[model samples]
Target: MKYPSTSTRSAIAALLCCTSLVPGQTAAQDAVQLPDIILDSGAVADDQTIVAEAISAGGKLTGDILDIPASVSVVTSAEIERRNAKDIEEVLNYTAGVVTNSYGADDRFDYFSIRGFNAYTYRDGLTLGENFGGIREEPFAFERVEVFKGANSAVFGVSDPGGSVNYVTKTPRGARFGSAYGTIGSFDTKEVGLDFGDVLNADGSLSYRFTGLVRDGEREYPFSRNDEVFVMGGLSWQPTERTELTFVLDHLDRDDVPGSGGFPIGYDFDRSDTFFGEPDFNFRGTERTTATLIGRHDFGNGLSFGGTARFSDGNDDFGYAYVSGQTATDANRSFFASDSAEKVAIADVHLAYDPQFGSFASSTLLGFEASRSESSNKRYFGPAPSVSIDDPVYTGAPSSVPLFADGETEVSGRAVYLQETLDWNDRVIASFGVRQDWIDITERDLLAGSSATNDISATTGRFGLTYKATTDLSLFASYAQSVVPAGTGVEPENGEQFEIGAKWRPLGGGTLLSAAAYDLSKTNITRTNPVTNLPEPIGEIRVRGIDLEAKAELGAFDLTASYSYIDPEITENGTAGNEGNQPARVPNHIGSIWANYTLEGDGARGDMTFGLGARYSGSYFFDDANVAGESDSYVAIDAAYTYALSDNTELAINATNLFDEKHVAFGGFYADFYSPGREVQATIRRSW
Candidate 1:
């Protein structure tokens, strides 16, 4: 038998003892100082943003939205809670230049696209892809969601040129407060959540927060379910006025049915209420754990440095019985099972200097980032008996499972970058940045007894200029470049974007309006290499779009409106037939408007608020060939009403797709994915 070492036991003992310390003691009185802390995780507090007019999406440096040359959207926690969003997809359903639910109502992932390409997910300014053991991000775990449009690889490192979404998680706070909520909704969904925060020391430095939620729910589809549990704990310590450290631990478990297989094309049945797959054996389960640590120290003299480190691990087990082809009516059913384990570690450090050089004010940043990930998967399959579409039989199929395939993959990346921003008399702003990344990938085909490794390097850059046209308006233009790694030996896909825009503070205090137009293109698309007979870059795609956004707070009304137009086409395709075709599932137009009004009630009624919103998405091609079919355009209606029971309590009801609009949200590889129907929920919340 083996036990913990003396040093390990000592550390554990010390941590246990700290929990027993009296809260009234100060650092001077006790040998150990609890440390002062700042919540909000080093991000600009929600209160500091004037009705979404200020943002930090372009760079980690917080600044006025007008100063950023790219289009950005900021969704605050207040708005998220008001709408009773259940997932990240729901939170972005109304944001501009985004298409949520691209895979319909699947819960296995937060799948979506920004502009015409996929958007990378980030937490606390760090990428959460394979580099960080990607998991389906829950909206409730975050305080805000910021969407940055266009390529940001110069600052963020390898990213989708369309954009990125940053989720700022909640943090501990100086003030002692707690809140709890209970919610019930359509589709047999029940949820309970708790959020508590408190200062741990008398000096007002050490603070901690514990937040968690347990939800049980069933999807609208037959034999489908969505249930999960999540917990997050955070601690912030400021040992000195100039130095601080924040740590967060998060865990999630998805124990119920995870995803649904879409129906066959032209099924002619209600998409939501039909079941074509096995009910007893079909399931998807996942468990993920993540830890993040952030530290910063101000060195004075206009110089500062900080670092962020994260580790994540997860396991996913899924089985599905799905369609095998597009032309099949009811004869091409298949059954498969896959089990995967993934682990990732990533870290980054940055130094910044804010100073005046001659007549120009400059803020310069230098940073380096690195990440490594390992993943393994085993898959099994068996012959599945076909079932009649009209008269489905639930009781028959092959029982033996045969190993289909197995493999392991390891990926590592390192990047160094520098960014500089200069302002001339606070009238003209110029920004430039460049980054170089080295990536290595290794894959082992266990079943085939083959292993391959590849190493690649790329450098990207970005430049922008912003002119202060007026005190409340700015005109800006930017050019950015990025590289997306395809595979080993496959030349990385390269993208470039050119954008011009204008931003205006319409009301001078609580309102903002912005409009942007951009032309973006990606080339070096991978194809089969003639020499190695492996995939290599030799394709191209182009996307152009215009976006308009407005957010404002007026006397008793809060309003948000957005409109987008995206035109995307495959300029070069390995398959000659796909050239000039519109990319699959890329919508042409999307628009939305949401408005809320608050009214003070008469003495007995309490205050009441009502909100109404409408979202529209234009129809688009569902396949690369544009021949199978096209998804139908539809409008979804959302409504909300909240009544304040007291100063610290409220009751609310929120509904989406109020009119029950039914249409295809996207087309899958073998079938068409339909949109979810109307869903309504009610919540009761209390805070201290």
Candidate 2:
């Protein structure tokens, strides 16, 4: 299969993210971090709500959530352990305005949508999922996950207007901690992990940390498997009281059979019992390494400077098969193979001033960022043997496939931004921000011996207002814009959003409740006409939605809940009769709630906790034409039970899809469109 030409721009954004590790290693926000805005005095909130007290992705760097007029969701390490998420999607399961597992049981990459549009994945504020290398990460390598809703090019120059997801890497700290764990579960799965860190010198001037994990498991599908090994370490040095520097490195190796959603031949056959493809010939292998350096210097008198840089190298090989045509029980299969290599480097630096004007304080920042990325890809597609849905025969193997596409893509981006936040009596805040960005991309079709170069530039900004009606309630409104560079000769896509919201902390700062409504639209979207089978660039679409979220600790109970409703419409489309139709595969109603209560000392089990969760997605159209009808709506239930064997030892059991609910996530897509079956696991951990 040939690679999508338009996907080339991801290389720039991906490389751009690699350069922002400075804001990430020291990023004190809930999840997403901003470059050049590193603050020396912020860390993850130590409360049970799993929400960060300060989050930069919301458009600023401050400890008070109510201070920023945007929507941000953070999931801390404490909650990560509670949820035991297996992948990135699971980490944001309870966050508002987001949906995951839309392709069912695919393990090759993490896919999800935020506010009716697909979101990009980041680590330490750098792009990972959107990279051309098809990067995949193990959740054990990160400390927390964060989500920033809506476009804010003023904060992040190039981003999806719908939203952003960021994972904070585990880094060295001044605190002492250690843990080791082992897990065994359904499908013959086995896993082990270790985490340890602490201050390495007197006065806590130096610190070190290391985290690693290994896992072996089988996918829900018959004869398929998933496995990975990952390790990461870091060192931090505070040479002076106001100066700090840190270095981090990580490596990952993985081999697995990618997941698949059988053709839309109806779900009459049992998914677990049917063999749709050649499992023996299917495989995906990956190896990657990355290093980052971050530093910040604080000058007295409300001035500071921060810098971060990162570089990464990755390689991947994949081979898979799918049904091309079929009779009642027999099917003709096709084979696809690809090998890719990618390199990315990015850096950022910024200066911030926080001048205290007595009762009227203001914080201002200016920064510059740049990134470059290059990727070489080779693709192969051909014919494979036939298979049966009932008693199958794997006689023929397509070990050789004809090369289809061979190409290389290079991308680079640079941007400068300025932001100012003014506070009046600590009760009102007005924010003004602007960003100017320039991007260049070059694509070389090696097979055809041809190359093309394209460049684009745009300016984006955000204006926001906040009013503190009381100590516990705040009302706010904001306008933000984002720009994404399309491939080849296509003009860049533009995203605009207008949002209004309220934040309330009725039960003190430890508890937060927020509601936001936004009108979001994107123009210059590239689409293909269904009838003519041709691409169109003048397409436009809109998604309007409301998000309600809560995170709080009531006595011994800590819980998070959210409900989101979105209205998606295709205002202008290349496909005939698609105008006014709902976007395919986007759900209108999405809601989820997760809570766990700790019980007092139990008879034999030290301390016990029981957790339960429910996730719901409303009906959605299956195609852009809205003629294939809507898909089945599904509600998935999850449950967990944990027992503390001792102060340092604990055992837990977790299960997802408790009832084995089966349904289609995206209809008629060759990808894994069916939801994953039931999964259960038991883990024992030792920590101090």
My TM-score estimates for the predictions, one after another, are 0.90, 0.91
- State each model's CA lDDT, in order: 0.78, 0.77
1-58 in candidate 1: lDDT tens per residue?
Answer: 1233354345334433433442422232332322323234443355233256566432
lDDT of 2 by residue, 325-426 (tens): 666777767888899999999877889899998799989988888899999999999888777656668764565899989999999989888989999997
> Candidate 2: how many backbone clashes?
3
Q: Candidate 1: misplaced stretches above 4 Å?
A: 1-44, 47-50, 57-61, 130-134, 325-331, 357-359, 396-400, 527-533
Model 2 quality (TM-score)? 0.91
Give the Å error, residue 687, model 1. 1.9
lDDT leader: 1
